[model samples]
Target chain A: MGKLSKKEIERVASLARIKLDEEEKEKMASELGAVLDYIDKLKEVNTDGVEPIAHITGMENILRKDEPMKKPLEGQAADAAKLVKMAPDSKDNFVKVKAVFGE
Target chain B: MIKDNILIEGEKCTAASKILENYIAPYDATVISNLKQAGAVFLGKTNLDEFAMGATGENSAFGPALNPHDHTRAAGGSSSGSAAAVAADLAVYALGSDTGGSIRAPSAWCGVVGLKPTYGLVSRHGLIAMASSLDQIGPITKTVEDAAIVLNTIAGYDPMDSTSHNGELPDYTANLNKPVKGLKIAVPKEFFSKGLDGQVNNLTQAAIAKLESLGAHIDQVSLPMINFAIATYYIIVSSEVSANLARYDGIRYGRSANKAKSLLDAYLETRAEGLGAEVKRRIMLGTYALSAGYYDAYYLKAQKVRALIKRDFENIFEKYDVIVGPTMPYAAPKLGELGDSLSAYLADIYTAPVNLAGLPAISVPCGQVEVDGSKLPVGFQIIGKHFDEARILQVAHNFEKSRQ
Candidate 1:
């Protein structure tokens, strides 16, 4: 309902961990503000007693067995290796990144 | 063309983002597995909006997929390339994911048949996640029967996707031979409001009249909560998108920001550089909505409104077999015509609500309109109840048969 400031946009982008350049920041601030302002109409609807419908299908807590199928599991493992190998740097069968233990 | 976002095993599934340009799909999604078992060929992957974020074809990182009907216009997206490919006969048929209106909107613009199956009716295993709760992979084809054929191949239970329906699958083509006489159809008045183009409204009404003449009953229905659809859809989807897209940190896969000075920079810069403008925009908005202080106001409220939208459809389906309306507001806009994200978001007015309710809806070409010196196709959408795909397909097929 309230207007979004540039600072708020930047903070949200940071929370999302997606860096926005100066131009993108102002643009995003305005665009998201418009969308936010538009959806502000939700406040007009009195949802005081309504329960939130998270999924469209009424099914809840669908649990497949934890055991994996061998064929697809192997295939998925191979694909995971291939994806890992795609990173900028991979060593010893893993993607290598900047050392996590830095000052 | 190589894909920007489709998940073909070991193939690039960039999802039209700089971040995932190198991201190879880890395995075949459940739908892809079904298609493979049916002996479907691997035509090269087509284009889509980055992270499946926009309404117009203009948002793809690769560039807009041109409408075959009017080259100067968009192909309608985020299933832009799939619809255009089918329209142009570039592929026999193509798989498209409809989170909100991606499948139906593109089909309308391209003059094809696109079916967004009941949310859980089709498996979402291999399809790249857009908005988890709303996304469903469906088919875009040249005919209703063809759409039915593709649906038959892909619809079934897949343990891989916990959301996949465990119900018995039907031969979608089996009911195409059935007639739709005496079927009750409702036209939601909210869908025909002010912004609907006059030509489109006329054509849609004409299509309904023709349906009436075919022995089906048509009635104008009021769904008071219809006005809240776009607002509710954006809030819920953006919130989910923010959560789903967070896995794109540099370490796992996709294009990593090797230049990051620290692990946190890797997350920030990778997403910043890899994602497109519309995608980043949704992420920011979603993040803001889900933030601790604002969650109740935006995300939770949207879900409650979503419940109301579902109830509206439920009440209508209680009387009518299917609900009919125009798919998009009008024909495809000229490439780059909608200059802002809000306009594109608003453009999805008619299509998104069906997704929110998790029902099956199909866009069948009703007729064409001469606009801006070129002929553009108009689509009429028929929405059916959950898991009631057979009836809608039968209705659409009957309509298709009547026209011919």
Candidate 2:
């Protein structure tokens, strides 16, 4: 519906780097198509000469001085170790990832 | 209590996703830190629609949380478990995020009070981002006063969040008993049109009449642009999701695609295996909307429409102190019953616009509708101007008091 297709979904999923199986892909295609069809209703609205709002706060150029807040961690090093363990693969307090370039 | 996504240190913030099943929050979110400072005890995390993506808890990696009110009905979500727990007396109150009615819908369904504060009124530093521009963490509780208490503790400026507001925080409780006798309340006519169940319409309108009897002046107002809000909301939110969720590759925290063949495969595999069906659908929607060739057509257009929607609310607030409506079109449907994504999204018709407008709104249990001989709670939504949460809270607090 409204130009959304399986091929299109596959293309977008690749861009997001998400791997969808055939079943999930099919379901997503139909669901996304329906959603797009609904949002397509916006075409009727005239947003002529309107400035797009990125944030509702209307605040911009917020800058803060470089200052570090103190952390009085009880067993700080142990806590740091606990946090580091959150990584799926880790070694020596460093998170390990698959090689980027070399095989 | 906690939602699956918001980090609570020493607890797993799985976000009801298999991907983050074992992922303990490395640190507390800013709200958690504030709650801890306020002497709040920590409870275990609860379920939500995966990554706050769905209208019902059915999308959770853990499956839908059963409604405590009726076993067959839903505990309306993405804050499914938060609302469910508080409804079941598992916790006194809980926190929920409203991207598109996540907090308010469930609170309504559970017959409790949930407030979606004006955006940036609360710090977003440690809370996980669903849509950076739309998401606001608020409280789901048993009463409006408790909601105010939570907001008072959590609402303030945080340097860590660039979007955080710098306004002077007010004593939300101070206005809980203030006179609402002369306040102006506008009920948007668009909210009462088709797609709203007739029974819910009557219940919501009767609640408005009750308020009128209590001395608040009420009027029928029209927000012609309301029809465009959900469409605009989905576009902008999904677009932001595509960007925010990209950080979930297998490299760092959360579940990683194990024994990967390549880095590319790792990224795909982890996201593929970790996220649920609803999340993948939204991710694809976001990805396609933000794709190079279509960005202008979908994302930019949506933002422009967002300005119009926001302007509509601002114009209304010029004459009315608050806007009243049904929090949702109907009472919570039976669990596992919202058959499709589009159907579920439609359920948020009345609530999502507030998020798009970036205004403060609250859902309080107003009346019940009998469905198949069983009674379920319905909610009355009251929306206020930006940073004017105190006024709405006072309205809700007084209304709750008046009920007793």
Against the true structure, whose DockQ is highest? 1
Give me the displacement of residue B96 in model 1, in angstroms. Answer: 0.5
Across B1-404, the per-residue lDDT of candidate 2 in tens digits comes to: 88877887677788788988888777788888889889999787888988898887888888789888898988898899999999999999999999989999999998999999999999877788899999999999999999999999999987667788987889999989987898999988999889999999998888898889889999998899999888998899889998998988978788888978788989989998888777777788898998888998999999999999989988899999999999999998997788988789888999999999889999999878999877999999999999999999999987888778
lDDT of all the models against the reference?
0.86, 0.88
Residue-wise lDDT of candidate 1 within B227-316, one digit each (tens)?
A: 999999999889999999998887766777878888888888888778888888788889999998999999999999999989999999
- Cα-lDDT of candidate 1: 0.86
Instruction: Give residue B171's lDDT in candidate 1 (0 to 100).
Output: 89
**Cα interface RMSD of each candidate:** 1.9, 2.8
Q: Model 1 chain A, poorest ten-residue lDDT window?
A: A72-81
The deviation in Å at residue B50 for candidate 2 is 0.5
Best model number under lDDT: 2
Enumerate the candidates' DockQ scores in order.
0.69, 0.60
Candidate 1 docking: what grade?
A: medium
